[model samples]
Target: MDDVYVELAQMYDKFGISDFSVSFGDSMLKYFDCMYPNETFKKNLDICCGTGTLCGFFKDDGIQTKGVDLSAEMLDVARSKYCDVEFIKCNASEFNDGEVYDFITCTDDALNHITDIEDVKRIVKNANVLLRDGGLFIFDINNFDILTPGEYNKDSFNGYSKLSLVQSRDSDLIKTDVKYYEHDKLIWQKSLFERDYSISKLTQIFNREGFVLDSCSQHFLDEKRSEKWKLIFKKVE
Candidate 1:
């Protein structure tokens, strides 16, 4: 499972089709401004922070940022690029440190990679433990409304050398296959799996895990887009 991500890490940034980096940065800033109003938060933790994209943004904003991912290969690339930001290799569902953070983010549909509901609960519960009171835990997942309506079978290209195919095995499970090429020859191929859970189910698990649901919006900062849902939760005091 994770080995796929390892193979993909080297080309992850180049393979991104959407303007996700810009949109994500803008969304995070909007949320941060809304939460702080007059001050800046101290620390941020990015879960499943593949390639440490968001971590770099947070660091540029002068926030002490740390990232955690299950793939050591991904972290290796991240650490190689970002010398200041810390990138730790650990499971998002059970990873923990003694220190708590002011803000946490797990974007790019990272939570959807956890196929088990129990694992989702563990991840949320751990987020509660890892956050201070009033601290935010923001994550995004594939909207079940969008995911279950039809199969996720699509083909796309990233520039010239990278090709991607997304396929759904069932309503709940999605697989993304990527191929990289040099000229006409295939260099590598990799596949990654993701799972989708209903918003209602997630709300129940979050509440049970001692989190107060703050909001759930589409596209993070935007309310109009209908594909992804960004869920915000705060650790109950």
Candidate 2:
């Protein structure tokens, strides 16, 4: 596993991550509304918050939002975007803290980075500890069925393109090769990895870790299962 994000941190917003975050954040707000109805969240924690994108959304909604990420470089970008918000540098497995939150989110396939199942279990335990009773944990992951492995694809934006290849290894992990181009010249390249876990397995783990699986949607509440699964977990005593 390489810290490809260290190099991509500055260009992440240009790489389409920010827009995707905004769109995904909208769906999360909708899901929260569906679950809580008239309730208001007092605090929110964005686990593995890359550029503080989702945190921005929560802040805009009047929720006190704080973010944690493993990359200081990524947090630099996030701080630049929202100087008022707090962005802490820390790994998911080491996120033990005294503060409790009403809402927690790990979006954009952040959990998949923990290839080890035990590490993932640790994160679940930490989530249970950090969340107040009835708090919600929302996250999304790459669904192998939709993001079928293969090839160098192109994602174009603002007259630039990111050429990338996604390969699914036999070990149940997915590897991504990303290259950014400017005017047809290579600017940057990165390698990223994601672990694949079946929805059933994740649900079982959540149950074991003291979370109740509230619901799951592909992308949005109304959307069908597609390239990813947006899962909702509620912490209960």
Candidate 3:
């Protein structure tokens, strides 16, 4: 495991905001329904499924779901809360099993954490190998256009909860600093770094991995430029 991922996994719960999952899950389900209205899938894989939020949602909707993440700590929390679902600790960039999945998802900018474009391409290729024919690949990424110009840096207050976020971008790295406050007291702070890749680059990589682009939608909840754009790809040919 990468040192950064290992460290972040330990503080995953403290820095992670659960509220975001509610809206994210709804959007994901909407896309899933649109793509496969009549199909009934027996097995689903949520790759890089931090805290297994999507897996929990799928289980609640009566689907058999399994989650994979790089962090054992996060998987522990996911397993403890969602006992019905299986959570495996594994790196998304290089994961393989003998079985194929009906659907595979890597959501919430999970792919951005992978530093190398070649690695991203490898992961997509592996995902293609792991999916049954016509299986859907749905994921999202924080738009570089939004983050490069440092538009995500700002302070917002909500009653007793206050949030401050800052972003720094250079040639090879993009770093985000976040601080959470409650009752006017500092609660926690986290620094997250992601490797940057343009949308065009990602699209090309997906194409090379045998995925046909389907749809791309701007993130519905947030209006900020740093918001995510949801993308759906179909395994074809």
Q: Highest lDDT among the candidates is held by which one?
A: 2
Error of 2 at 200 (Å): 1.5
**Cα lDDT tens digits for candidate 3, 204-231:** 9888888888777785434333377777
Top-TM-score candidate index: 2
| Model 1 lDDT tens row, 10-101 | 76776663236446756777877876687557698998888888888778878898999889888987898799888898888777888889
Report the alpha-carbon TM-score of model 1 versus the true structure: 0.87
| Candidate 1: stretches off by over 4 Å | 17-22, 35-40, 147-160, 222-226
Q: Who is ahead in lDDT, 2 or 3?
A: 2
TM-score of each: 0.87, 0.91, 0.80
Give me candidate 2's TM-score against the actual structure: 0.91
What clash count goes with each model? 0, 0, 0
Name the weakest run of 10 consecutive residues (lDDT summed) in model 2. Answer: 161-170
Clashing pairs in 1: none
Model 3 residue pairs with clashes: none
